[model samples]
Target: MTATAAAPEEDGTAPAGGGTASGQDASRPVRQIVPPEDLHATELAFLAAHDSGPRPPGWRLTPRSVVTFVMGSHGAALTLPDDARAAAGTPRRLVIDGKFVGDRALVERCVVTLAGERALLLVGEPGTAKSMLSELLAAAVCGTSGLVVQGTAGTTEDQLKYGWNYAQLLAGGPSPAALVPSPVLTAMSRGAIGRVEEVTRCLPEVQDALVSLLSERRIAVPELAGGPDGLAHATPGFNLIATANLRDRGVSEMSAALKRRFNFETVGAIGDLDAETALVRRQARAALERSGAAFQVDDAVLEALVTAFRDLREGRSAEGWEVERPSTVMSTAEAVAVAGALGLAAAYFPGDRDVLELLPGHLLGVVRKDDPADAARLRGYWDGPVRRRAEEGAATWRALWDLRTVLEG
Candidate 1:
């Protein structure tokens, strides 16, 4: 029988009529939030003695189960025993969220690189979802996403290494208490994936701090008097994943040495118009639903919006028509945002003609973020590719093109 009662006060005292009268079943299991995968590194090694598979040392489940945990599986349902299950609560459904939207082969390549000994660097334009994917990968591998170093202009060697606590440093003179481990150091000790986001944003000197760490698989702290002699040795399954934005080109370029340490993968922007449209539609619907608003967007309006973005992104249209691309990145995330704006407009205006009426203006707002020269690029796209497509008797696109003045005005 299930028991429902108000929780007791924090002073360790019960309310009136305490003692089991509250119908409290003290033996009930508390809910937990574990990853969908059944095993962890230590547990996997213990199971390896009885089970049969290619078990990598320090990994919880076999590599195959790890894959299923991340991508979801259709075979036998993997489960944890009641004891383990109750201790950790129910496992999170292995729902692989967006990281990279483009190539499966690239993801496979990254997975393989991590499975081996190499570090992986995900390079892409801003808002292309590189860091998100890295987070997902790290969470999948180690069952934790807490190890991270966010790269920036002000990031220092100490931020990536150990920093001395001033009070402890003065008291004990570089003792272990004075040493505070950076995220990278902690990940090395735990054998988990350490993430560094916006890697190129860090100044060259600061970025170089990773070179020694990756090559040696250890962090050396000369000042700390009594911590592992000199080096902080990495545990067995430790790895690193870093993300750099390509749009931030020419700003603090990565050293050749650091580049060689990682297997680089460049994530591309959404190229297919249909794919972009579908993604926008799905994302917008979900957002509206979350907001407790009814999603009533027209499919044709979404297609037009995506087509405009694709043309501005690629500097061309589907039918061999030339268009001037925008200086801004026409990312999938931005497409979803624009679609969401239109949805909001629909919810408010109710009769704002159609969502297509808001497309060109939203496109203009995004493309005109930086240089005024971007305005010319956007106008060129409409005149060339959009004009050609409209002239070719594409009805829906023609209607959107008719709103070209929205860009100029």
Candidate 2:
């Protein structure tokens, strides 16, 4: 049965009644990071309570509510009726939180596509939150986002379809009980979203496994055809959400046949600097707090770091100043990581070691990858953007420009 989460108390946090995936163990002093599906269980229930719109088969919320869950509620409120509240002996109101920040039109299109049969494919440059968006969509569509396949060169067809439990196979032969369902198969049978991450990282042959499953909406278990197990046909709501890095596109490009089965959506980096900076600080503080550390990374340092990354990522300033783009992706994810590291450094190793001194080195680490020429490209960044910005009399730029030697190391 789908669990109904308790409405939030006067504060935003949910009441204790609804059991969520985020419930901590009383026996162990450990932090458990919950997925979107679990973390927003109550919120989803609340949305469902107020939704009167039509939904696709097997969907938990109306398409409108799904979009609201992602883009956030723009002052939409759902208050329990007086009679219902009195009857239930509880008072509650549902106010949804906007989770993902991006183009509303894009999110609306994605929701519309997922409501139908065509699989959704999100392609983007690194750090674009393509995967995060996919997860949120999956969680909101169904109630679980655990059915996922991480695509890699070594990922086999068995991982996408079905595998044999060796012990059961040996003891009982290739029977129904011996067959282990892959995430894709599990999603197919249960009518849930199955995710394929880094789809291009897998070899052409292995990646092709999805083509048949998606087109036919089924997977045949040939070995058990004569017995109990045969074809696993998809249920009404079965769908796929695949993500590929733009950098990895041509590596093992999906065949045109495979691409045709998907609705392609591109997830790009945050367009606004303030939004990106807030995301960085929010993610960094959350990460730091999880590690039992106070986040003391200065706002000035974060702004400087995000500004540098934005410049390097776009190869141009917000003012349209030209800069040399790095060969590697300087994604917002990398920026969040750098921010987290800087915060931890401040909390643990408090001293005269200036946080600004570490920015150039961390950026160097982000850019210095694969191609040897990337380091040169980063050095060129310091000379061009850093030099120009410092000349404009910005103290942060002046400090980073002064530390040009750090990039060299």
Best by TM-score: 2
Per-model C-alpha RMSD:
9.5, 4.1
**Candidate 1 has which clashing residue pairs, if any?**
32-89, 40-60, 41-60
User: How would you encode candidate 2's per-residue C-alpha lDDT over 176-291 as one tens digit per residue?
Assistant: 88899999999999999899999999888887888998899999999888754688899999899999999999889999989999999999889999989988898888688667
lDDT, candidate 1, 46-163, per-residue tens: 2222224564555544555444434433332333443333223223121122323466666667777777778999998876768766865676667666688998898999989878
Candidate 2 clashing pairs, residues 3+ apart or interchain? 72-98
**Candidate 2: deviation at residue 285, Å?**
1.1
Q: RMSD in angstroms, candidate 1?
A: 9.5
Q: What lDDT is obtained when candidate 1 is compared to the true structure?
A: 0.69
Report the Cα lDDT for candidate 2.
0.82
Could you give me the TM-score of model 1 versus the true structure?
0.77
